[model samples]
Target: MHQLIASPHNGAFLVARPGARAGMRIPRALYEQVASIAESGAPLPPWLLEGARTAWDLDLAGLTMRDTVLVRPETGLGYGRATYEINKGCNFNCEHCYLAERRFEGLPWVGKARLLRLLRDAGVLWLQFTGGEPLIDRDFMDAYTFAHRSGMLIEILTNGSRLHRPEVIALLRELPPYKVTVSLYGATPDSFDSLTRRKGAFKLVERGLAAAREAGLPLELALIFTRHNAHEVDAMRAVADRYGAARTEYGTISPTYSGTPEPLAAQAPGFLDKTGVFQGCPAGHTFFHVDPHGLATMCKVGRENPVDLMAEGLDGLLRLPGIADAQMLRTGGCGGCQLSGTCRVCRPLAKAYQEAKAPLNTYCRHGNEEA
Candidate 1:
């Protein structure tokens, strides 16, 4: 396997090691030089030799470009990042899950391979594989290996249920991911199992975490706070500390992607922090999301005009910027609100709250002040 990946990212060139967070950005001329060296099997350049050692502790003293560097061909398409939902199936039945229905379905292996290629053609360098639990998917290893070999830095968003499995751990150990983000429900079995509605869920996840840590896998723990386990916030952080992994906390909850109100009931009281001002995001312009069936959208929340990648191919993505712009517009219920200038919720999110008939205080500034 190549030790490093050299690719064009959003019009700039970057050299990153597999399973590493840090990378070195190189100029276009240097990228071209590296590509030529790799193609001709030239010796490692002195600059790269020293830079790789300094950045990632990687030594290229005896390796040629062909053995150490994988030069990804440049695609003029501007996109640099994407999230692909491998499958929506999950073993856990968490009440706070944003999916109204956790359906166990997705495209077959052939379609998945094609979609990854299309993403590569569109210049996607940072790819995240998410799901109800991506590790449980039947073809996840195949798809992950394919994408990794294609020069995309991969991240897996998982529930950590399968991290204890020998086969899963072995695969990940062999082909490391940039990051494996596991969601932590609670600190203890009672809270964790109760929240997930699974009798042995906590034990499984605990085992998974231990196994991942032992293997030195790049791991991040997402500590999720819900009414069911809000009291265990400190304990959950302790769990992350014990594992020696990076961590993040999530307190706010949202309605289901399809506008179902069920999940909002799990929101922990006093945990909802006021959202920040709505600065425009580069959703469709620089990054996009893909559902199981190869349907591409601007982001996870704004699923309005989707591009069917399977049917329309990469050219279909041409319509996404317009679709993203349309979805972000302050139309419908938000058409003429006086607070639009300072509104924290974007139009698509506000629309979901409206569809769910959510209490105004949950999402609206006016409702917050009234409360």
Candidate 2:
């Protein structure tokens, strides 16, 4: 059965099945209205009801048994959301970072404004501000204020190291984000600081989280997986609950975006799903990732090639030659891969062909097994 849910961060998303791996974002009010109508057992116009169901790829008329959802949010490209990495420079030196090459240097305010304008013009409703740490940007507030005034719902992904500062907290209080997602590396200062490699960084994260909560901002916590902190997984979740986070996101570490195995040594056991089969990646179609340098790609990982957003405008980049080739899923070498069912590898990662033309075996349960 299909159900509409408000993610812990309060975004409206629809799940086709009870435990579907992915959910489609939808307009919150519309989803609630549909659910309320369903609960009341009052029949609405058939076309209206069917429209929501067919919003994605699940055509109820054609695939009667396959569950589907239709997202009709107010914002998005032809689709409703976009992720912008505000800056690549980060305060922490985590051993598992994919963008280790990112220095604090990034696009200037004018460049950022241009990018934001492009997204707004594309009809995007949800704008996620991510970073090495977005708060560190000298002009973060300026960019943020612009996006907020542009009428886009804003989301934030941060390390929570700087939220304790009065100025940072004050800015958030003035223009609250739709949600503030903090990455939890460990539960205790020792465990956490070890991963971050900075003394007392954990305390800063704690203060940051507390400051956000005290400010009454929507908050969620995600546990970043690493072999160094595997023992503290449960305790980290407990910390998330203590903060009353709306949702808790956690996942295993994967190879670097460069397809290097250097970081694989930090991966925990049981990271990938063996039972799942390959499904098409949603990057470029339902989602896209843009970095601090104005380089756009399907996702953050395996970024061998990217559309230069500054050199070529959004329209020009989207229309560039070989655009389709860059986004296509590469599974020919996977031995009729079942890993796609639960695999984290996408078109770019697959194209990188790490681990001998298969997804990184460290993250893939079937990486070493024959099909």
Candidate 3:
């Protein structure tokens, strides 16, 4: 197992540890030198040895390049980030889940290995594993280990129900992830269980959080506020603080990825935050999302014109940028809207709202006016 990874990120070179949040950006000359040293089976340079110790408290003193460092080859692909849904299966049935269906279907282990290799070949370094609940997937551990060994910094988006399991904790301890982001539904059992429609759900979450905290895992909390638990927002914050994990609050609820409007009913009345101006994102150009069955899309929202990675391989991603640009055009209901200049939502998101027949005030400046 390598302790450090040196990879080309976008147009730059970065040296990072597997589980660390911070990385050292090195010059092109230094990256080349490091690569040469790895090829020559020489010891790591003194600068990297001392820097790793000071920056991440990692001691790489006498380790040679072959044993200490994994030099990731540049694939010439611009992609640097990706999100893969291991499976759209969750142990809980949260009313506001963005996935309309929670089917426990995905590629077999052999196909999953092929997909991971394809992602690595596509120059994906920052990878996130998400799902209805990723941890519930039977092959999650195997897939995660493969990705981590492939030199990708991984972040797991989970519901925290299974974090208390000894096997999960042991694997996470052995090969730490960059982050484990858990969704906080409610602070108390009654509210949480009621919201998830799963009895004893809160206890499991609490136990999971406690175990993760004790294990010193890199954890974060996504406080999902809905009508079901809006009153407990403060309590949720307190829970996050208690665990010493970073927290982010999400109040607005969007329709499912399939454009189903049922999830919108759970939105908290006055808790919706105002979205900022529409700056562009590098969804398909530099980042992309892959579903459980190896279908790659621009992002989680714009699921149109997917590239079947399993069938078409890494070359299929060449179609993504064009598909992404086409999806972002201000067409359909937003085609002639003059206010699109200042529209907060992107075209893909707006299309979902339009498909759901969501109230204009929720996503448009026109309020209740007809489109």
Which regions of candidate 3 fall more than 4 Å away from where they truly are? 365-371
Q: When superposed on Cα atoms, how far off is each prediction in RMSD?
A: 1.7, 10.2, 2.0
> Candidate 2, residues 172-231: lDDT per residue as tens digits?
777667688898888898778887888888999999988888888788897876666778
Q: 2 or 3: which has the higher TM-score?
A: 3
Best by lDDT: 3
Q: In candidate 1, what are the lDDT values of residues 1-371, reduced to their tens digit?
A: 88899999988999999889899999999999998878656888898999999999987898878878989888767899999998999999998898777899999999999999999999998999998888889999899999988888989998988999998889888888999999999998999998899999999998999999999999999999998888998999999999989998888788987788998988898877566778788998999999999999998888887999999998999999999998989887788888777777878888888889998777775423643
TM-score of each: 0.96, 0.73, 0.96
| lDDT score, candidate 3 | 0.90
Cα RMSD for predicted model 2: 10.2
Worst 10 residues of 2 by lDDT: 1-10
Give the lDDT of residue 339 in candidate 1. Answer: 77
Give candidate 2 regions above 4 Å deviation. Answer: 1-79, 271-278, 320-325, 331-344, 351-360, 366-371
Count of backbone clashes, every candidate in sequence = 0, 11, 0
Better of 1 and 3 by lDDT: 3
Write down the worst ten-residue block by lDDT for model 1. 362-371
Q: All models: lDDT? A: 0.89, 0.65, 0.90
